[model samples]
Target chain A: MRLELETRGTRTDKGWRDHDGFVGPRQPGTGPRSDPRGDFPTGPEVGAAMPDLRCLTADGPAFDLHAHRAGRPAVFIFFRSAVW
Target chain B: MELQKSMRDFDAANIRVYALSYDEADALRDFRDAHGITYTLLSDPDSDAIRSFGILNTLIDPNDHPWYGIPYPGAVVVSAEGTITRKFFDNNLAVRAGPERLLWAALGEPVVEPLADQPAPLGVQVRVSLDGDHLAFTVQRDLVVRFDVPEGRHVYAAPAPQGSLAVDVTLDENDRLVQRPIVRPASEPHALAGTGESFQVHHGVFELRLPLAVNSFSRSAAPDITISGEVRWQCCDDEVCDPPASRRFELAVPVSGPPAHALRDSRAATLEPNAAAHFRRMSERRKDPG
Candidate 1:
């Protein structure tokens, strides 16, 4: 099923203004949609296709999921800390 | 005990057990050494694999800790075709996808067994509240129900001492709980307590208290304070105590006062195309084999 994965670091400006009724001037180079390409500085754009990459095994061998999947199914076990 | 026994069974079956994490190599090595972990421990420091799987959640603040901005904890069983056959996701860190269930899925089998005139202990409700650096909560009766044991059946004591059953209460963020549970042990020790205790009992009621570092709580006000946690323990009556089970629960604690002044709206920073591309590229590089 198609999933719309929200980009990791997209920010919204809903609470930008202060209580003094002063419409804060957009900072230079920080206008609405400044980076029209949707490339977020803080992190990757949400929903963008993840790039194909390889992981180096403990034995120093590199393993690529896409390459290994060469038609076979593979499980991408996601974990926060390899140490955990 | 049966669950531990089951884990031993799985270990003997030659089924692969891969424990994935975002920790650095050194840290992983240390963890393996400390736990004597026999399973595979894989590291994903860049979180590339987690993000690609569409299981990342950036909104959860890390309470200004150094180890922040990691992917949510989850497990997905992928078919031979690379499609996810079964997926388990947890925003809270303390919760984990059951290893046995995952193994069952990998083997294309149903993990849960049918109730045989006796129901397994089920955790129905959980509540967590921040008491300074400690988290206190109660597991209602319904949540602690276990199968009926015959008149003579008994189980071993929980990991804690005779009176104190140490039920390790951990946060959803997976932060190690520093505080010990305020375990109120039974007044009488089971005949089995010392001499190779086989059966234990958590009769009508029990309470647990655990300590956590205060800094784990987020300082941000707009987002509201939320706490998630899990309990891993086995319950048994007189007859039979089913296999061990782990249950996860979450609670949201609201901050009373106005928003904190230190909280800044970091949204003003513009998205940098180059930076985003760089991160994406880094992610890809980490995942690529050649």
Candidate 2:
């Protein structure tokens, strides 16, 4: 599985630029190689515990996936603002 | 969205539908009100959910414009226990999980059905025949279809505008033909062509012919060919067509030999009693509300 991380806005040539990042290389047998500036973190690092956040529904109920899972199953979806 | 409409018709309750986005609640509320959306639309303003799902686009173009950073649209079926049953995270935005297909998945029904109605909003059918062992024919090959439109109803001509009647037919798995059928009145509308036009007298009976190629068969030994496609058309009997509904049909055709060459015997035969009977039975139950 390909993994990605959220980098703070410092273009240092090593962190992911904009929001885009590449997962595993298309061709197999080739190990992942980071660029000189180290733009993207390796898959293992990015795959670490994902950050949990709160969501507000139209009904005004606040939801947090980590707390709501309660040892059960939950689906987290991310969508863009239609305004954009 | 039409997805909700399909879900309502599917009549299943086990799997829940939740649409999430990074938009704020106010934006989601506005969208819901504008579209009269009936499904749940959750807000993920901070991109946390988007990041967790790993669907966010983050690529920047050479022009310095950010092209990636949005979540890749997809659907995931989670079992009651929370395990992921199925996940589809492709980049195609227009494609979605069909209502019936989702129901079937939740119900643990077989992935393939022998008689799922091919949803075609348009009114056109193509027939093909297998000659010997090589070559296949398409509508361009002289295979003709005579649509028996119900009284007071008319099907539009080909090359229809988007969201208009545009029927298509293609051979499915397990299907092999000698010659593919062709369409007649190549340039004239169905109402104008008069010749090679067929009509339906009652509510159910409709007939069409298709030609096939000589070697349309796959290497499999099975004699069944799966016909899968969508139809986009309007059906109105002098008055109303419920909305332009896009229906999909997946059919399994048993290939024995080539369809008889004689015009009188050229009509494609319907499948006999099979699993389709079960579907019809279910439809019957739904129709009887009481």
Candidate 3:
């Protein structure tokens, strides 16, 4: 199954800038990639073999999506925030 | 949060659901405990997996959205054979896929819609009405309520200190409407007859009108909409004050087109004039801007 990933970290390439626009530390990268796909490996699309990726569980355990979904259907939901 | 509610349906379809977020394990645990979430929520603090998904939201300025490494909010359904079967995405950031919609996307079939006509009384001897002749789907309307306390008893008013309970009206979360609580000045300065302690209170019959703004509407062309919530307050007599009391209420109203027969009922129409006056005052307040 195709799964979208949700992001939470605040640090950009630039160290940290206040709302006032004062840049500090490293400058932030434009982060625009010519290719639409950033770093995901190719060939995890429909009718293709699912990619095996290692991700951390919310309870602090190393988990693999394919291993967890062993011989079963699964749905991955990527969302913003529960409280936001 | 709504996803957890449809876990049983997903399970019945042999489809397991997983939610990915940027929150750390500890924060996710706290969120799960607070909301009683039973599904598995994974952590992705660095957003490595999100970037790999090719759906990273790069359009948003990093400075403005530091903590949001959001993936265009969506879901993917995988077959038992590990092949991606379907995907769902929407451009609207404010609206998320509800449980029924998510299940529909996964199963490629229609899901049962939630029922919309449950109604019940919330407050004893209380009345509620809409201020306008016709409800507009895009404009804000007044929900006027008149609360009555039997003679010799009084209920605390706004700004009532921590020790006393104040009359409160809380609207349940709604997807179609944005609700704002009502604010009003207490009746003429007075104190309890026995305590002699100074406090603003509602006695006999008094009115409160709140604003409900329409954000988006359901497909139903009929203006009928049901609002559910609770009213909490405490009453005090000359001798003793009773413990705090609360009740659930469901108020259904016609939103557009023709008004229902109940709206024309003599008892219901009595509060419309007051609602109109309240609207006038509100408009004046907005214009003055002092």
Candidate 4:
């Protein structure tokens, strides 16, 4: 796992970079690799019941996943960020 | 985001969609208003939910500033009963699960797209089609190669009997395209009658799905990109195996514009006039909160 590289503090060459380019505290790739074999810890198993999620909505309302959806199918996504 | 484009299909299928991020709720609100995002956007500013899910990207150091506290981006599809039917967590930060793939996982079927009229090999039908009308950076869509093997016939699966070739799709070398390994259906075991040999084969109907996304760094402004590839297979029955066959395919796939995040750049901000303002506010808020 390339993730092991993260443990080596400030070891590798590539510094932080975003859309603006070459932006600090040294890391390896600074991002995920493209290999499909990377079986990163993907949370719960497929058949496992989804844990209830409690968080704030974009509108600042307290949102509860299971309660709001109420037995409906759902696609829950975890993304990097809206901001760069 | 590609999810916005597929909102209609998800709605039609009665599947609710929600995206969560570590950003503050206000930032997400601004993003939604700016991009006309129809689905729900959740906020986990403290990364509590991210940690609970066990997908928090541990790669970034504690003091990595804004890069820290982010999850390894992924999507999970929940059945009506709340079981996690499928999950797409790519190691690549740029690659994301296309909406069609999510819909397929939720629907428990292939999201079928009719292939353009083309002749098939004798007794076998091969159809290849893409899930979306266009290809975009990071958002993955399936390049589906379907095979309809005639009854009493089968195609060699991977590790095809030494000399035989497995049914597979190989895209020509293209720097613009990034592809994941082909998703093959479970191959059936075929037992030979005389020599006491057994091998894997696929009969009837099956598909080999190539999850493809455009490399964001390709930096092309063209309206369409030519995606060419070859499909090769050797069809065989109990007694006879046809010679290895291959057919080359070329598709002019339309190009989708840069993702919503790219709108923050001055050039792309023209698409949505408020993009730059929202981006400024978001970056300012997250900037070195010491």
Q: Which candidate achieves the best DockQ against the true structure?
A: 4
CA deviation > 4 Å runs, candidate 2? A1-54, A64-84, B9-11, B60-68, B111-290
- What is the docking quality class of candidate 4? acceptable
Question: Candidate 3 residues B1-290, lDDT tens each?
Answer: 44565688888987778888655565566556655777778876566777777666665445433333656566777777877776655433333444554566567754222224723223336666665443444344556666767766778887675887888787887645555448553564456566786877777767666666443323356567777787778887657778888878887776653221122345423523233333344334334537
TM-score of chain B of 2: 0.38
Please identify which of the two predictions, 1 or 3, would achieve the higher TM-score against the true structure: 3
Give all TM-scores, in the order shown. Answer: 0.36, 0.37, 0.43, 0.85
The best candidate in terms of lDDT: 4
Better-scoring candidate (TM-score), 3 or 4: 4
Candidate 1 stretches greater than 4 Å from native: A1-53, A65-77, A82-84, B1-8, B11-14, B60-65, B109-290
Over 4 Å off in model 4, which ranges? A1-3, A6-28, A31-37, B111-122, B260-264, B267-290
**Candidate with better TM-score, 1 vs 4:** 4
Q: Give model 2's share of reference contacts.
A: 0.25
Q: Evaluate residue B114 in candidate 1 and report its C-alpha lDDT on the 0 to 100 scale.
A: 32
Judge candidate 4 at residue B81 and give its lDDT: 94
Report the lDDT of model 1 for residue B180: 27
DockQ of each: 0.14, 0.10, 0.20, 0.44
User: Lowest summed lDDT over 10 consecutive residues: which window, candidate 1 chain A?
Assistant: A31-40
